[model samples]
Target chain A: GAGVSQSPRYKVAKRGQDVALRCDPISGHVSLFWYQQALGQGPEFLTYFQNEAQLDKSGLPSDRFFAERPEGSVSTLKIQRTQQEDSAVYLCASSLGASAGGNIQYFGAGTRLSVL
Target chain B: AQTVTQSQPEMSVQEAETVTLSCTYDTSESDYYLFWYKQPPSRQMILVIRQEAYKQQNATENRFSVNFQKAAKSFSLKISDSQLGDAAMYFCAYWGGANSKLTFGKGITLSVRP
Candidate 1:
């Protein structure tokens, strides 16, 4: 793909329902990142991945938030028991590995999740 | 922990005019990277420009240029001959080398009046 792609551009989930957002990064990008953005705030880092390894999950707000990059090419962010506060835009970004300096990150359009 | 700050919540500039957006950061690290990203109505994050803290010379991309002052830990973006399309939410971000997360400011909403 020419750029990072995210599925379900818009989603509405009832409170307590689970939602899964997917990301397809540019082919061969070794590093992947997930961020959460509220209505008027900047994107906040949630997790990071290097290949198939989930190196950083420190930013996840609570135990309900989970992310995985199984094959290192595609990733998924699953939210369990979604709450009204969970409504936000989920962004996915990819970058070259450390050897490339990881200076630039390409981002997806993001999935807008609405929890009622 | 590093933090980026953008004081202006909203700014307005007329088309063809020049406008400057201010940003300040606090970090103990000597070396790092600064970036400016634009998010329009479509909500896709786009890289506008980047500056390496180790370099004295500022970065310029077409009409976008930055005035980076390492001593003050300030990185400001100057848009020359602004266009209507330039209207968007602009963010200032920071990253410290590899394995580091990018910290972003709250963002400034830029409005270009024709």
Candidate 2:
């Protein structure tokens, strides 16, 4: 892909329903990250992956929120029993590596999840 | 704990004019990174510029540049000759090596008047 790609640009889920959002990072990108952006707010980090290794999950808001990158190239963020407060944009970003210039992250268009 | 703050919620600038957005951060780490990212209505975050903590010189890319005050923990973005295409939500972010996650401020909506 020319840039990071996310599936289901928009999602509408009923409360208590589980939702899965997908992210496909750029080819050869060694770092991937997931973030949550509330309405009219900047993004907050949720989790990070260095290849298939989940280096950091400290940012995940709750136990209901989970993310995995089994192959290092693609990732999924799943939220169990969605609540109204879960409504927000889910963003994914990827970088070439964790080195000097790799700090620059390329973001996807993001998935706007609306829990009703 | 590290935090980034963007006190201003919105800013407007005349086309072809220049505009500077304000940002302040708090951190104890000596080695860190600062970034400015732009998110248009399309919702894709694009990196405008970045500055390393160790660098004494400001970072600039074309019309976009940053005024980094390491001592005050301030990093602001200046867009010269602003264009209507520049209209978007601009965010200030901080990254510490130990944290490994980007901390972002409440973004500022920038409108370029044509």
Candidate 3:
């Protein structure tokens, strides 16, 4: 893709329902990241991946939030038993991994998840 | 721990005028990266400009530039000749090191008036 792409630009999920958000990064992008942006707030880091390896998961809010990039080309963020507080925009970004020239991260039009 | 702060929740600027958005961050790391990103109503976050901690010179991009004060831990974005299209949410972010995750501030909503 020309830029980072996220699926289901808007999601309305009922509490306790499972929701899966997808991200398609730029071709051959070595690094991918997931962020959650609450209403009236900036995006907060959730997890990062270098290739298929999950280098950091420390920022994941809870056990209910999980992300994976199994093949490194695409990624998925799954939320199990969603809560009302989970309502926010889920953003995905990609960059050249492990290179000094890859500092700029390109973001996608995030998926707005509204849990009711 | 690194923390970025944007005190202004909202700002307005007349078209073709200049405006600056304030940002302050605290970081123990000697070398890191600071960035400004713009998010329009479409919700796509785009990088506006960036500054490296080691760089004594401020970073600039066309109409967008940054007044980076390493000692003061202040990084403010100045948009010259602001345009109506410039209306959006501006975010100040910090990265500890290369390939590090970003820490962002609360963000400021910029309204450009024609």
Candidate 4:
């Protein structure tokens, strides 16, 4: 693909429902990141992956949030028992560099999730 | 941890005029990166410009330039010859070397009046 692609550009979930967001990064990107953006706020880091290894998951807000990139090219973010606070835009980005130091991330259009 | 702050919640600039957006960051690490991202109504995040913390010189991309004051922990963006299309939400971001996670500031909404 020419750019990072995300599925279900918009999703509306009732509170306590489980939802999954998918991200298809640019071909061969080594680093993948997940972020959450609340209304009128900047994106907040959620997790990071290098290849198939999950290097950081410190930013995940709670146990309900889980992300995985098993093969390293495609990733999924699953939220269990979604709360109203979970209503936000979930963004996915990928970069060629393994580390963040010199990497320029390419972002997807993001999936706007609304938890009623 | 690095924290980026953009104090201006909203700013307006006339067409052909220049507007400066303010940003300040707090970081103890000597080596890192600063970035400016623009998100239009379409909600696509676009990279505007970037500056390396180790470099003394600023960064420029077309009509976008950054005034990076390493000492003051400030990285402000200046948009020259602004156009109506430049209207968007601008964010300042910080990336610590060796980490993929980026810390971003509360964005500033830019309005370009024609």
Best by DockQ: 4
DockQ of each: 0.63, 0.66, 0.65, 0.85
- The CAPRI-style docking tier of model 3 reads medium
Q: How well does each candidate superpose onto the true structure, as a TM-score?
A: 0.97, 0.97, 0.97, 0.98
Candidate 1 deviant stretches above 4 angstroms:
A99-102, B97-99
- What tens-digit string does per-residue lDDT give for candidate 3 at B18-76? 99999999988888889999999999999999999999999999999999989999999
Q: After superposition, how far is residue A47 of candidate 2 from its true place, in Å?
A: 0.4
lDDT of 2: 0.94
lDDT of each: 0.92, 0.94, 0.92, 0.94
Q: What is candidate 2's CA lDDT for residue A89? A: 99
Ten residues in a row with the worst lDDT in model 2 chain A?
Answer: A96-105
Put the candidates in DockQ order, highest first: 4, 2, 3, 1
Candidate 2 positional error at A115, Å: 0.5
After best superposition, candidate 3 residue B42: deviation in angstroms? 0.4
Q: Which stretches of candidate 3 lie over 4 Å from their true place?
A: A99-102
DockQ of 1: 0.63
Q: Give residue A112's error in model 1 in angstroms.
A: 0.5
Over the stretch A3-103, how does candidate 1's per-residue lDDT look in tens digits?
Answer: 99999999999999999999999998889999999998999999998888998999999999999999989999999999999999999999976323334
For each candidate in turn, give its C-alpha RMSD to the true structure in angstroms.
1.2, 1.1, 1.3, 0.9
Model 4 pairs in collision: none
